[model samples]
Target: MKLNYSVYLVTDREMAGECNLADIVVAAVSGGVSCVQIREKNLPTRQFVEEARGLVEHLRPLGIPLIVNDRVDVALACDADGVHLGQNDMHIKDARSLLGGQKIIGISAESLADARRAELEGADYIGISPVFATATKTDIAKPLGLGGVRIIRDNVQLPLVGIGGISAANAADVIQHGADGVAVVSAIIAAESPEASARELLQQVTSAKRIV
Candidate 1:
């Protein structure tokens, strides 16, 4: 599968407000989100599995990849396109051994060394996170400003997706700094119009990729 990391949406139920996750995902995809990561940190294993399965069913036909955040078991159970592992999550080698070569594996990197190690461990992509401080995730690391992003981009070969406090306003700068994509949480999901937010973000990402 050719991964287009252009506009990645990382789901947060609380941030989604009144809209159902499925509905939010469909709307985001319709507005041009290239990938969706189901990130339910508070849910129990059973509920997480169910959510992953439902998202997979919804995204599969649309040709969008469903990535289970920090849950290899959920990803395997749902037959999801991939899994996104945080720094403290399962080891990449173990994940690779379990998911095999076909499934996508992404790692969260907070520094250049983390990014380099992820690439060496065979991650399909690296999420360079906390580009700015974010309220959506409480356990965020130090914010990686655009300069940090450029430094990591210069050091890693894997596709870079900038996360944390990302919105349409800063999406272009993120990409211009060498992120192949931007992973947003609250910006789209919490917006009154998820689809329009996604569209605007996608437009910014597309325009940035072209110029950079």
Candidate 2:
């Protein structure tokens, strides 16, 4: 599949407030979100699997790829498009061995070395975590400002997706710094109008890519 990381949505149930995850995701996709990652850190395994399956029903026909966060089992259970892993999660090689080479595997990188390692280990893409400090995920490593992004971009050829504190106001800068896309949490999840927020962010990313 040709992945368009342009506007990536990382789901956060708490940040979503009263809105259902399916509704937010459906709305966001309609507004131009190119990818979706379902991240459930505390939910039970069964529930996570069910949630992912539910999303698959919504996204499959739309041609959107649904990635399960941190759980190869859940992805397998739901037959998701792929899985995104953090450094502490399962190793990429093991994940690839289990998920097989056909599924997409994304890794989170907090430094240049991490990005390099991910590339060597066969990650399909690299998510540059905490491009700016973010409240959505407190345990993440130090923010990798735009400078970190540029340095990593210089070292790796894999697709880069900037995460943490990304919003319309700075989405352009993230792309200009060399990210192939931006992965966002509350920026779209917590918005009053997810469609509008997604539209605005996608516009910023698309415009910046043209310049890059």
Candidate 3:
């Protein structure tokens, strides 16, 4: 998948305040978000499928991909572009058999071992989680820090996306440390202006990539 991972947005409806999820996504994509992942942890299966289907309609027109988080079934139901899997989620081999080779499959790696295994298992990309401590997800591992990103980059050839506690302020640093992009949650979703926030984040990642 020749994806431009810069300025990745992971959704959190709870943090969106009064903004509608699709509305926030439209505004963010208009600003510069390259990718959007629908991550509904508590929503029922039917609602999750409905939400993914809705976002796919919004994103497809803009040429942006909508990734369904940790739910291959939901992705299949919605005809989403891809699915993001946690380290403990379904085996990549099994996921591939079901989704086929056309769909993108991203694996979250909390450790070097996890990253290596994902690559060996044929994951399309690697999501480096908790690059810094984050309140967004209560059950994440310890922060990997910038050094951890460099370590994973050194070992893996796939694209790297740094998630957890990422914002415009540190997005450039994350890219400099070797991430192809930053997967942000509250930084964009909770902002007063999701468009402006996404614009700033894309700018940061773009500039850093130029330097790297």
Candidate 4:
């Protein structure tokens, strides 16, 4: 599957506020989110699987890929398009052994070394995190800034998605620095109108790419 990492949406049930997750996803996708990741860390395995399955049912028809974050079992159970792995979540080799070559596998990388290692380990893409310090995730590494993005971009060959505190205002700068895309959580999910937020973000990314 050819992935368009532009405007990647990582779901946060709590951060989603009053809007339902499915509704938020649909709105975001409608507004041009290229990828969707289910990242509920507190849910039970069975519940998570069910949620993934439900999302798959909705997203599959739209031709958008659904990635289950940090749960190989959930991905397998739902036959999701992929599984995104955090540095501590699962070994890339182990994940590949289970998912095989067809499934998309994304790894989070906070440093140039981690980015290079992820590419060597066969990750389909590397999610470069904490581009700016973010309140969304507590375990994030120190902010990488645009210079860090440039360093990682120079070192890695895979597609780069900048995460952490990325918003419409700063998204273009992230892409300008070398990210192929931007992975967002609260920027879209927490907005009063998720669709409008996503559309604005997509515009920013595409516009930046043109300039680059």
Candidate 5:
């Protein structure tokens, strides 16, 4: 799986539902979001598949890749640009086998070992953090800060996205810690203006830390 690291935006289904995922996504793209991930954890598989495809179709012309969270089946059915899998979801090898080599495959990791394992298994990139505790996920990982990022930057060769509790104000800190990009849900969704929030985050998270 090959993906160019850019602004990767993850979605919170509950919050997205309140304001309309399609609308926010469209607006976010217009506001300069380069990629989008549809992460609805509670929906029935079939229903989620349908929704993902709808999003893919809508974002296709705009050129932003749509990634389905955790479900490769849903991703395949939707012909999504890729899939983002958490630690417990599926092995990277098996995901590659199923999705083949061209589609994007992202793994969620917190520790250096996990990031290294993902890279060794052929993951395109890895999401690293809960740089801070986040309301987006129920079982959030402990905060990593710059120390956690340096560990992965030191040990793994894959691009990393610093996720969890990231907002425009703290985005510079994450990138400074070695994240290739920053991924957010609540920080953007909960903002008064989603588009402006996303744009600010994008503007803030510039320049990846030089991994030594």
Candidate 6:
């Protein structure tokens, strides 16, 4: 796992073709993204693998860790830096068995208990949030708000990233509560210029990171 990136960006398929996914990722990297997760849900496994392979090639040379969302098979096929698993995706142990040591694995945590469990199970890092509600999830967890963010900060020691509803406007508050970084999608992909948008958010995240 590279762990070279501090700003983590999750790609939504809506940005495909239109946004030049690879270019946006590179721009994000230039803007200070530490990691990129190629998250294209609903694509057939073969289609997903094809896309993941292209991303692996694009990111590998740049030295950025590319994480595939939900599918360990595709991750292995592309030799991705890691895989990010949701609560119901794949058990951490199984993923660990497959990826073996030296590969990164990230699990999502919505509560303190989930965060603790992820640590105990050998996850490399954890994604914690809906620090505020997000329209992304069909059935989302209760908003952690800042209090929940603080609880995770006090209870866990691993690298932490806050996801869901993160934007430049309130990103400072999220990292202020104790997230190592913020994972974003819409804020960059939806902007008029992804690279410029990412640079702005990266500035905010870096400033927030310094104070935290």
Candidate with best lDDT: 4
Of models 3 and 6, which has the larger lDDT? Answer: 3
Q: For residues 1-212, what per-residue lDDT tens digits would candidate 1 score against the true structure?
A: 66899999999898777789889989999999999999997999999999889989899998999999999999999999999999999999999899989999999999999999999999999999889999987787899899999999999889999999899999999999999999998888988888999999999999998998
User: Which digits, one per residue and each the tens of the lDDT, describe model 6 over residues 1-212?
Assistant: 53743578999877544767777777777777778999987889998998888888888888888999999999999899899998999999999999999889999998999999999999999999788888766577899998899899999998889988888898888889998888888887676777787777788888987887
* Model 1 ranges with Cα > 4 A deviation: none
Off by over 4 Å in 5: 1-4, 207-212
lDDT, candidate 5, 48-156, per-residue tens:
9888988898889977889888998898899998899989998878888998888999998878778888898888889986778887776876788877887788788
Models 1 onward score TM values of 0.98, 0.98, 0.98, 0.99, 0.92, 0.95
> Model 2, range 80-189, lDDT digits (tens) per residue?
99999999999999999999988999999999999999999999999998899998888889999999999999999999999998999999999999999999988889
Clashes of 2: 0
CA lDDT, candidate 3, residue 156: 95
Q: lDDT tens string, model 4, 1-212?
A: 87999899999999876678999999999999999999988999999999999999999999999999999999999999999999998999999999999999999999998999999989999999989999999988899999999999998889999999999999999999999999999999999999999999999999999998
Clashes of each: 0, 0, 0, 0, 0, 2
- CA lDDT of every candidate: 0.93, 0.95, 0.94, 0.95, 0.80, 0.85
In terms of lDDT, model 2 sits at 0.95
Q: Candidates sorted by lDDT, descending order? A: 4, 2, 3, 1, 6, 5
Give the CA lDDT, 0 to 100, for residue 104 in model 2.
97
**What is candidate 3's lDDT per residue for 167-192, written digit by digit as tens?**
99999999999999999999999999
> Can you give the lDDT of residue 185 in candidate 3?
95
Candidates in order: C-alpha RMSD to true structure: 0.8, 0.7, 0.7, 0.7, 2.2, 1.4
